[model samples]
Target: MVKPNRPQFTDVEGLAAMVGHGDAFGVGGHHFARLPVALLRAITRSGVKDLHYVSWAGGLPLELLLEVDAVAEIDLCFSSLDIFGLPPKFRAAAESGAIPVRDWTALAMIQALRAAQQNLSSMPFQLPQGSDMLARMPNAIAGPDPLAGTDTGFIPPLRLDTFVVHAQRADASGNVQIIGPRALDFAMAGAARKVLVTVEEIVPVGALRQDGRQSILTRNQVSAIALAPGGAYPASCLPFYVTDYQALSEAFAAKDTVLSDKLRLPSGGLSERLQEAAKVSAETVLAMPAPAQGDKKASVDEIIAARIAAELDNESFASAGAVSPLANVAYRLAKATHAPDMIIATMSCGHLDIAPSPMVLSLIESLDCETAAAHAGGDDTYSTYYQAGAVTHEIVGAAQVDRRGRVNTIALRKPSGGLLRLPGQGGMADVANMHRDYLLYIPRHSVQSLVDGVEIASSARGLLTPAERDPMGYRTGKALVFTDLCVFRLDQTSRELIVIETMPGVTHQQIRDATGFAVTFDAGCRELPMPSGDVLAALRNRVDPLGLRRLEFVSAKERGALIAEILAADRAMLERLIAAQKSPAAS
Candidate 1:
């Protein structure tokens, strides 16, 4: 795996000198700026280049973000907000008809590379078989050999010459560690002809091996490692350090943020922000604990049983009767079981007040990011773990469900019209495919949402038929349909939907009445526990005051009763504990 010794560049300027003017550069994840912003700006400003990116290029990494400093410019497609880290200016530029907008999915790119690595003629992508996107990139979809008959026209394979990445740490020999989902980062390493890595620390070859199989990134594919301390500063994580959530949010919010801004960023602006953010003190940040180490994994059977219990007891939390029981269950489960090395949670984009804490901070305080990311899943760094494969479990909100355990987040039938639609299908398709453990977080028993079978044709884009079942050996590894009243999981053998647990207030009949299909109920379903009074207070006072806020909306009676009942129940539990503690006879 020894790389041929090649000339090294000392700085961004030196690196730019080697790449020369007008050369095309492929960045690993266009989610945001990864390279020095200064170099990106310089390259784009010269106006002597063609920049091609494999990411959705219209948002955060917009061309104007680079052009502001006269750095560099790129002309490419994939201009929708669907691209993970695109800046607003980039989207506007595409809308302005300045740059071409190409529609493509990350999966398509990954599969293309997979096809290339395997030396296939071309890969058959599932979606967009007759898509408008295919019409634009005829060459991309058209295989080199027309006789091959493999292209499905949804998305074509992407071939790149070089890929640049920023890592938290890398050995001198090039093994790297990405603390979270370093999306497409690995694929890029394997797909590209050359890989350039900039890292915070350069460890000796033996240092990375000390961790054994725990190493998230292997260095053999790396062509170069630049000891750029703070090199990925404000852009990449250094493990224990804080993720600049505000900076990323602002970058997403800014009109002109772009990949060039990230690549050739001037140190001066970020330095000041870093200093200000650092005023919070390193100790505060470091206090966050990593996921409590040494906890064992919860077996699939164990998880099914727990969900049953949680569902049975869900009423305590749903009714605002005392969320402590629910919180305690989560806390205890987290404490007792080994958390995944990575976890992903789908959160709504709005509602900043409850946004999840930074990953580093979560590691310090809670040791997991689910609750935190649930609040901030819409933030720029959302879904980073999806590409990284660090997340073993992901909880997402679903709009509908079927008897077969399939869930849908978008596109349902409307009372007025035959179809009601959101913007379009999105990451759910990928998340459903990727998550080893998938939990659908939704309120129980929505009359309209639970479907007996697949409804609309929106996802006909990549529909896998029933006959095609288990073709890939991917059964939804773990699924828990969480609702206000009950929780359900797919049976291992049948994949038939099964109710594992019910809320304290909800009866089996109630659940049956709620679901559209005949649900197989656990005859001995358990009830969820009541949260501790203290945890209930924290949740009521801090986590959620309204109790019903997490729900889309609740009636006045619903809110008042749910809140008062939950608080009173917790108070009752607390008083009993206090009385027991005070009784000397008991002692």
Candidate 2:
């Protein structure tokens, strides 16, 4: 019943053969969703080396390649394990200079790919002037735009040799259907010389035409198609399975063993091993100790969230990106309380008109997908909103903050020539350049973080005064910082962050001691307003009933304890099963 002349229908091996050594590859998926894992496994089995990867946010597949020494270079906006924390293998490789890295912001990456798709030589963008990211980027040139007649940065086109993507379904004729928010997949595919798609299912021809909106690719654009159910294992495929958080936790806990023994398995055995590992992980999570009840005390994360929520104004459009659970909580709490009409846009949830259910550990899974007023068309939506100055507020965090409120979320080059590469700038650069107001949320305030100056300015208004900002297309947004101990506001005249208010228990000396540089206090500096009974009630009872905020403070020892308990339970279960089988009277 299958038609042979319908397009090239192939298997993983065939897909791998299409990829050659030293080819520049573009991968689809953001964080943990819809990754082309099966094809990546095949490529690993084929022992391809010296690959160059272009990804929006490099996740597990990219980390695996780094571990195997197969990747020569990486072009990415950000790279991490999401909620599970850092990707150890990738971090080690990047820090050791094992692989070359070219970092880009999420917006810049999309713009560059878009330029390639349109056959343009380059794309102009507005970013924070004097940012170290601009200086490091080889292709990014800084100058006044001839067309716009303003200061701007231009990124050259990035065209890949091959692009691999995963979809929910596809017809035999190679028409691909993608559900949920399509990240940079469409543009990446269009900009690539060849496109390969692995889908969960392959339907009959004309099956996808029923919903034309979901069909993002046609036969002309697709080079080949393969059926790869659960191809994005470990990562969520949406409407199919959520991310395997427990498995990732276990993997991170035992990174050496997992990466060496399990992830290095041959293609024929990798999927099976991953499935077995996932089963164990599921059991471990089900056996985790229940959180203590009857404790109504607010956690450090909750306090930070509540304070940030109070800063939101009604009827304003606010956005939060990845690794910002506290910011997302604050946005939801604001909607539930003071800002009932606030429009919140999260990178995972898109545009949410209504308040999402109580916070969960994972933003991608718990946020309301059905009720999202609109999907954030990935980086396109972000860039469009920013350029149009539609985003009023943005909540972001960074690895380091200088006296001038500048942020650095990139590498920390040591005097000994060692490197400590943090997750890249993501969309913070775009947010700094466009939004009317933005807040920096620092969970841990210390001398190291509140430094005199950053080695590299990733996002900030360095020397750009209000006059300069206007000419450069930068907004005159109030730059405020919220930390665990105090609140700091940037002085309009000095551009230096000065203490505006201290927390309930914090002292002036504490603030001074925590900051690396000499501290300055405003004349009106006083204690921050404590969270009212009403705000606490809404946050605990409605906004975060599950008490998931505790995860942010969960220590490594606690995680080890949980893992030990899981192993004990597994052993006991196995022993009981063996005893029952032995006692059943051998036949």
Q: After superposition, how far is residue 421 of candidate 2 from its true place, in Å?
A: 1.7
Candidate 2 Cα errors over 4 Å, as ranges: 1-7, 209-215, 256-295, 348-354, 362-367, 413-417, 462-475, 550-587
| Per-model TM against the reference | 0.50, 0.86
lDDT of 1 at 583: 55
Candidate 1 positional error at 543, Å:
8.5
- Tens digits of per-residue lDDT, candidate 1, 1-587, equal 23344424245444444343333355543333233333344335545344555432333334433355322344233332221122345534444445443444434555666555555666654333212333333345544335555433333345555556666667655577654334455555566666666666667767765642122456556665566665544443423232343344344445554544544334553443332332333233223222231233332223322442333221111100011123223323332232222222322121111122322211212222213333221212223444333334434445577766565433455676554333222344444544445566454366565667646322211223333324433333456677766777766566567887776667888787777888787776786554444433333333222232322223333543443443443334333323333452331
TM-score of 2: 0.86
In model 2, what lDDT does residue 169 have? Answer: 90
Which window of 10 residues has the lowest lDDT sum in candidate 1? 314-323
RMSD to the hidden true structure, all candidates? 12.5, 7.0
Q: What stretches of model 1 exceed 4 Å from their correct place?
A: 1-7, 17-25, 29-42, 45-48, 56-86, 94-98, 124-156, 169-181, 202-225, 249-394, 397-427, 430-587
Task: Please provide, for model 2 over 1-587, each residue's C-alpha lDDT reduced to its tens digit, 9 standing for 90 to 100.
Answer: 11223358898789888888998898887677777877787777788889998887777878767766789998887887765566776788788877888888767777788888888989887655546777766588878778767677788998899898888898867778887667788888878887878888888887777753353667777888888877776566655555555555566677346353343324553343233332222222223332333446666777777888887878577876766767777888898788878888765334445355444333334244434666546656756677777777788877789898889888787778788888888777666757777588676789878999899788875533568657645567667888888889988788789999888888999999899989999999988776777888777666664554443444545645544453444334333323333453321
Residue pairs in candidate 2 whose N, alpha carbon or C atoms collide under 3 angstroms: none
